[model samples]
Target: MAYRQGVTELLRILASAVTALLVAAPSLAPAQSSQPVLEISGASFRPLPIAIAPPIAVGDEAAAADEIYEALTFDLQVSGLFEVVPRKAFLADPREPVGPEGIAWTRWSDVGAESLVKFEVTKGAQGPKASFKLYGIASQRLDLGSTLEGRRADARRIGHRFADELVKHFTKEPGAFSTRVAFVKRAKNSKEIWVADFDGRNAAPVTDRGGISLLPAWSPNGAELAFTFFKKSMEYPNGHPQLWKANLGNGRSSAFVGRGDLNSGASYSPDGSKVAFTLSTDGNPEIYVVNADGSGLKRITHSEGINASPSWSPDGKRIAFVSDRHGTPQIFVMDADGGNVERLTRQGNYNQTPAWSPRGDLIAFTARDERIVFDIFVVDVATKEVKRITQDQGQNEHPAWAPNGRMLMFSSDRGGKKSLWVSSADGNVQRKLGLADDGEYTDPAWGPFTK
Candidate 1:
């Protein structure tokens, strides 16, 4: 009953908005009688053209409005669902009102925008409040709209929230813009673990103790991170990598598995109760599983060749890892207890960093082609069909799937520097994430959607 009531109210709002537009701008073309179904995923998908008008700042909200606008624009462009129209081609005045009566629908149409977005920022009781509206130009309908209030310092988050809502309107699944991404940013003497927004904004170091922390993996609930820390002062005191856990709340960390000669590639189980990692306590590297608290340690793989990069399946019944037992490092899947081992990738001779999709349908990984250039690829779990996601984009590696499995984040040298980049699941849309820091970013771990 509540769902129906919300839909009824949305229809009423759209009716009022469209009626005002038609009456105020009668010379415009009549609204289309029908709308096309949008396909945001799959191979047949085409990006929808949308126009995001300049934000209308009210009172002293000009700065906050600009920040929100920039964030919203970036999210839309990188979403792979919409092709944002450049503001330089806009024919309408920039100061136009967001109300339906004042919108120049014909101008937006001339600019080849099927949908239009209008944002308004006002001073809220505590900080800044924003109002967002999405209009279907052809149908003259209000497709989506929301009003949100947040701290002025978090204006960017307000924009992210609106973008998530917009994506949900079209795909029924919310966007991953509000999520965080953990990555390794290499410094002169240390490779520190850092966390930032999905788009690489508001980055802050998670570990500042001046050592190397690699392969940052988020717990399913996002309350903690599992990584490999290398330091000479640990129990081993040998500077060997050891699995560690960090509480994101208090920024405290402790070794999770320190007895092994080397422990790395920590992948949290779906339920966040366990972690599967690679340990070299034996003569060679092998996949191992341990409880989240470092108890019940068990080796999962026993192979002559190295076995590493253990990624748990969504159902927790299987684990995907990399193995060179067949003479080439390739993706392999085995039961959680290391039974029924089966090779998953058959093409590339050098394939590693297999990231299981949250949907459990695909596993994204990095491979070196015949030309020795690294690229991202995904293999279907059922069909074993491999699809290349990046090509000729410089070296790209360490693919990590978003929580919804609709997108992936990896590191790329495409811009002449190694940085974080994100792409759609089908590789149709790709964009480089913007980070202010000047250093190589790698091993990107896209966190789960925030509460």
Candidate 2:
């Protein structure tokens, strides 16, 4: 009931804040019905036949926009939602500053194309600007059009944004291919938290206090991070580990729970009203829920053994956690109010870091095999079906799901050093995150994008 009460209070606060802000600046309020709705059924209906022609050159600029067009086309194709017809395959190119002419719609229809994208490149004050237009094949009407201004080096990001907008026009859900990941970077002497765009660009260290920071978890809004840091001194070599929250936007941070002893593994509630963390201040490591402002602390579990890794369900109705209360670590689920506790895993000898999927269907955790090799596995909450997700190589652990629940990000030693790797929810298409100078990066946590 504490979690529920905390969430209720948070919702009330947010509602009041929004109301006050709206009242103070009515003009700043967003339009009630500005968002367009694209039915998910559209995905099953039919993928639009899209044709992307090379950008028309402007002035003396070279052919730099070709790479941007290719990247954008590839991004749309990977989403499993678009049918891109090659320009070479087409009888004629649908270049910009011109309309669909004698070109056979029959050819596109034969190729299963339902849409077309035509673009042109122009020289801008800053750099090259790309102008694109999307047209529905059947209606021969424009669906969306926009111009992106950026330097040649930033063409990739601009292309991703363009594709993302295109996906939103047809799918209703925001595309996450352009999002970034935040995680903790650890070394022998100290640990720091870092963040990078999804493609592993613009990675920078967030903490540089020289303490042993670990277990970085993102707030639902992606504006703040919760992590644990150990303060070392001559008298206490091991140091005292405490939980801290950092506001990424303004570089402001504060200690979340300063009771000291050992407070770590903090995860924010789905609504960002409360945080569930493990505290050993009471002798044994146990799970506790507290308000976002660090008030009204309530213990959730009182098992004899260690209980940690609390993850909230998407609807904020239940929490999935890991517990060794049954001797070895196993996945457990309980109501948000800390009632109706039940065990969810039975096959694995050891299971830890249970992450509840955002889709609210499966729970991912690290399971050790008979050979004591740890790998990632998912368990269906309803059917209790256990499926192993990781297959080869060294230990793979700390599986974190993307906001859309389409893929997972986890830490692995498969690349000779501990680095972040992403795979489909079923553990396919595994690829390294390609971070800069990978020096033992672990415990990756994906954050929701604000836009």
Best by TM-score: 1
Tens digits of per-residue lDDT for model 2, 253-313: 6887867477888889999999998888767888889998889889888889888889999
lDDT of 1 by residue, 1-451 (tens): 9999999999999999999976555333223333354776576878889999999999999999999999998888877788899999999889988866677788899999998889899998879999887778876666666899899889998998998887877777868989999999998888999999998988999998687889999999999998999868656565878888889999998887987588889999999888999989767999888899999999889889999999999999999999999899999999999999999998989999999999999999999999999999999999999999999889999999988888889999998879999897778789888897578899999999768
Model 1 spans with C-alpha error above 4 angstroms: 1-37, 233-238
Predicted structure 2: lDDT: 0.77
- Model 1 accuracy (lDDT, Cα): 0.88
Candidate 2 Cα misplacement greater than 4 A, ranges: 1-118, 125-127, 133-144, 150-154
Give candidate 1's error at residue 371 in angstroms: 1.8
TM-score of each: 0.90, 0.77
How much is the lDDT of residue 266 in candidate 1? Answer: 94
